[model samples]
Target: MSSASAQPANEPDNVFRDPAFRHFWFARLCTTIGYQILTVAVGWQMYALTNDAFMLGMVGLVQFLPSIVLLLMSGHVADRFDRRIIVRTCQMVEALIAVAMAVASFSGWITSEYIFLFVALLGGTRAFETPTLQALLPSVVTPRQLPRAVALASSATQAAIIIGPALGGFAYVAGPGVVYTISAVLFSIAALMVFTLKLRQAPQRLTAPVSVKTLFAGFAYIRSNPVLLGAISLDLFAVLLGGATALLPIYAKDILHTGPWGLGLLRSSPAIGALVTALWLARNPLNRRVGRVMFGAVAIFGVATMVFGISTWLPLSMAALVVLGASDMISVVVRSTLVQLDTPDDMRGRVGAVNSVFIGASNQLGEFESGVTAALLGPVGAVLLGGFGTLCVVAAWMKLFPMLTNRDQLHDHSAHGSGKAATAR
Candidate 1:
């Protein structure tokens, strides 16, 4: 996966020209859609079963628990085994789980406990699949196409994020069993595609015995590099503080003088913005001052959050959300490119796993933070404070992580390894 791997003369410049990439991309789309649909269907089923808000919350808890519990071990497994097989296995298992859920739903035997058990199982498989897939991407395409691939991947995810829930909700009308059956089919398709992927060369699987040091090696590697640490942590803090989406319901209903329709628009605005940005970047890759650009994007994210927080007008609020989404996409592309290009082939899984955890923590914890702060300070006050905190984090991070601020190119990461923290080792 080195940058020096020459693209074959017969190879086309476009990422889609590679059959492997096309298969990989389509597979990702299917799995994301299936999982998102599962999420919506499961939430609906859980609430209907228990009629309890706590059980509804438990659905999310069951999913998050697996990532925290298995992340280190899963990272170790990803690095040691063939990533394609790992991903394929996870997909297959998820498909089986979907089948079971479908059967139960149709049989009138699906209980809240049954749903929770399977959901946790699905979450566990994803913990393994996610990091492995991140590691697998560089091998599917050349280093030259990695950034474009990352952008395309982002687009697939964003599109699925929007499509999955909507489709699930629509299909649920036909019956919960119909939604579950569709999910099973989609997961099976993804599993088949993942198994078919051929890496440029066979990976040299790690045969070393497992140990505490080996399990946590990803953290050690990240800590060894300031740029890597900065890029990864910057995202964590920025999103943690600037997350205003959790408060969108309040704004849409109370402040903006609108209804569920307004809330839907508010929610979709940022995702729509992100999807467009991802498509744009896929065609026009970031080639210069990526670090500065990432920071700048984050700064704009903070600003947009603040603007959205205080704005009373619906259009103004939606506008701010769109800008916020666009800026977040830029940072995502930068961080993804940096991680893939900067790390070694063998270590990609471990690094990717740690990266996944940071992302998960930022998202899960950020929502909690928003809820608590919103309760204490009120919705507008919470959002405004979060945005201001994001700006402060940017300033502090710029001064603290000089390596990230001064970083120049995504492809030339290896060339700029003058600092002790330059390479993950």
Candidate 2:
């Protein structure tokens, strides 16, 4: 089917204004906030147990390594099943994991090893859930509303990132156990909300038997498509080099001379900035010069990272982080819209899974990079050098993928035969 043909005529005129979308959006927001709480709680607890930066990296490693291993299989599963059910199942698993952690923490049985195990389980569930969620978005609204939906999703996530850490920090001061318990409760609520959503399923294709060859097709697609490869690489390099979140505890305790509350603010500053920009973009979508905007935003992100690295004042550092967040959000929306528009529906699951791996790698690998660099060069030097490194990557990518740089408008040309790409200039 042609991209235009994919638009369901029965779709409500006010799809973007649909109540179901709002419920879905709120569920995602709640889950993200809970995830943030768990992240901070685990990191703080791990540091208190073992002061090694490498161990901090280990936390991220455990979460992402399994994701890398299982992503292709996860994609296959999503393609063959109901996405909503997949999402609900994964959320339920996540809720159980949260409950386990809460029990461990509250009962004084929580340990670094237990946390690692919990993170690993969470990663496995995410391997299945992430692709399903991404693939489900187009089903929730018409193609014309996708840009708005994407913006709303991004803003909601950033909002969670903004509030989660602050709430986690406060909860931590009261007790780590309390934070874990609260996260569990929130996760349960999110799962319940997801259960209440009424999404129409897309028609499935009858395909040839699945095999290892089919499994690797997603990787082959990514390797062969310049645009997809370029976008993923851009994200990986920028985030891997510029990610400073992993080292926030060090700065909070040793550098900034701040309490848990201040640490929360510092951690959340970027997301707050991102949320502001995302909300604006939601109101006024970026319909032109997307390529230039993406590149410029990423460059600005690098610059902000550099500034944040050197700033001793809390307010200046927070301001720098805000800029970084805003810049990152711009890149996020541009790349995501491009990817979704370019991908074929039959291949959405596998392609989205591959994208998830890139995201996982960028975040977890970035955490590892930050921890190791901080250990080797001290926090200031590590962050400053990382910012410079990100700039270098962006410059190189811009040179290598000139097509991405010069692209004047989004197109839906398929690079594969699975089906027609579902958007156009």
State each model's CA lDDT, in order: 0.88, 0.80
Give the Cα RMSD of candidate 2.
4.1
Task: Name the lDDT of candidate 2.
Answer: 0.80
Give candidates' CA RMSD values in order.
Answer: 2.6, 4.1
Shift in Å, residue 143, candidate 1 = 1.0
Backbone clash pairs for candidate 2 read none
Which residue runs does candidate 2 get wrong by more than 4 Å?
A: 1-16, 44-56, 105-111, 172-177, 200-206, 247-262, 374-378, 411-425
Candidate 1, residue 416: lDDT: 34
Query: By lDDT, who's the top model here?
Result: 1
Off by over 4 Å in 1: 1-12, 413-425
lDDT, candidate 2, 1-425, per-residue tens: 58657776534334457877877788788888988998989899999988886798788778888878898788877776777788888888888898898888878888889999999999898898887788777677655676767788888888898788879988999778888888888878878877887764463531746888667666776666677778888998999999887778788878888888778788878888899998887778777777778888999999999998888888988899889999999899888877776666556678789998988788877977998999999999999988999889889998998877776565444343333432110
